[model samples]
Target: MSMFRHLLGVVITLLFVLLTCAVILPILMLALLKVGLPFARWQALCNRWLDWLASLWMDANARHQQLLLPTQLEIEGLDNLSKQEWYMMVANHQSWVDILLLLRIFNGRIPYLKFFLKQSLIWVPLLGLAWWALEFPFMRRHTKEQIARDPSLQGKDIEQTRKACEKFRYNPVTIINFLEGTRFTTAKYVQQKSIYRHLLMPKAGGLAFTLAAMNGQLHRLLDVTIHYPEGIPTYWDYACGRVKTIQVHIRQVPIPAELIGDYTEDAEFRAGFQLWVNQLWQRKDDLIESMKSTGAN
Candidate 1:
């Protein structure tokens, strides 16, 4: 039964992707060009279309696969969110399905979510063009070793990318960063011997840079915690209908006033910010444990 279910899920997901690439995507791309909207507007329009299509696909897939979303999923403190406000969303990475879950949950309540991606992905055929069209921030990350070998490369790339983000000033945006940097695996967990349960160590550099660039313009921080009841559910599970329930806890937090400055420049503020992030990860660790315990029953 599981094998058959998996096969069916893959077929459906592929069909959806093919249809999206062949039909919906080209029309949207042409529409953006015809309207003469800026890249940010074009991206926003594309994301809205993707979000709607995903929801429709999920509903149809769920009904066919006999899957169910959480009936008692609780979103606390959502009332604190303002439609006019800009936010920075940070979440622990788990699976590719996490993106779809976020889109479904935060749909109309918050500004459309965007992520900083690698510049290389910009040429990735269909999805690449789509991401570029959507105005996703594509960055070139240089390692310390590379920078040390070539002393002149210090802050050039980051500064160039930061300048590109200036265009976002005209549009309300919610920037999301998966602080863990990569999805969790037992091998990686063993390699890092991570302090937090079910989480990798939070990478502070990206968050630091993001906060520095956005500064006072971002009104709040959305700390979201997600858990899958039956291990880490894959995209196949979602499509095949094997994933019946998912629990997500959203805590809308105020961006600490002191963190509004350039975190890279101030030592004291940087230490304080790192400590706060550690505390958030610790709490998320505990939350994951509690969810696992509840799901066991």
Candidate 2:
């Protein structure tokens, strides 16, 4: 029965994607043309259209999840959120279903989440072009070892990343960062000898760089923590209605004056920011423990 359920989910999801693409592709072509021209207003107009399309796409997915999954989701701290404000959303990564869960949680409460996708993903057929049309930032992050091999390449790539974010200034945007950089696994936990039992060591550079880029424009940081009381659920498990409980806690942290600084050049600021993020991770680990203990989730 579960296998059949998963198969049904797969078919439904594919049909949803195909239907969305069929309508969006033509609009995307026109938006792409407007973006290519030199008119700023036309570009903004196109982005608004893209946002509307993205919102509709997310709403459809959310409705499907609600209808198919018999899961109890407890969400908190999004009461005062406005769709007109710019937000930096940070979360921990656990499963492929995480993104879907997030979309369902924040569907109409905030602007559609825009991710900084890997440059390599730009070749992923329909999805790649969809991301581009939505103006999702495509980034190529350089490792420390790679930068060490070529000293001059140090800050250049980060500058490019900052430049990519420039387009978001025209409208309210919710930029999400998975600080752990990858899904948490037992093997990864053992390899890193991670201090937090629940999470990996966050790569603070990308978040710091994003903060630097948006600077004064960003209103607040949405610190979101997701926990699965029954265990980490796969997409198939979610689709089969096996994911019994999902606990999501969102806290709005005002962006402090100190957090906005040149993280690449200012050593003191970088150290301070990294410490802050590590402390936040520790708190989240404690929250996850508490959530697992209680039946509230």
TM-scores, one per candidate:
0.82, 0.94
Please report how far candidate 1 places residue 105 from its true position, in Å. 1.4
List where candidate 2 sits over 4 angstroms from the true fold.
295-297
Stretches off by above 4 angstroms in model 1 are 22-80
Model 1: lDDT of residue 47: 55
Q: Compared with the true structure, what per-residue lDDT tens digits does model 2 show for residues 105-188?
A: 997898768988889998987778888778788888788899899898788777976897788777889999999998999999
For residues 17-74, what per-residue lDDT tens digits would candidate 1 score against the true structure? 7654665465455546735755766756655565455445444544433333322344
Predicted structure 2: lDDT: 0.84
Measured with C-alpha atoms, the lDDT of residue 151 in candidate 1 is: 86
lDDT of 2 at 76: 80
Clashing pairs in 1: 43-134
RMSD (Cα, Å) for all candidates, in order, is 3.9, 1.8
**lDDT score of residue 252 within candidate 1:** 82
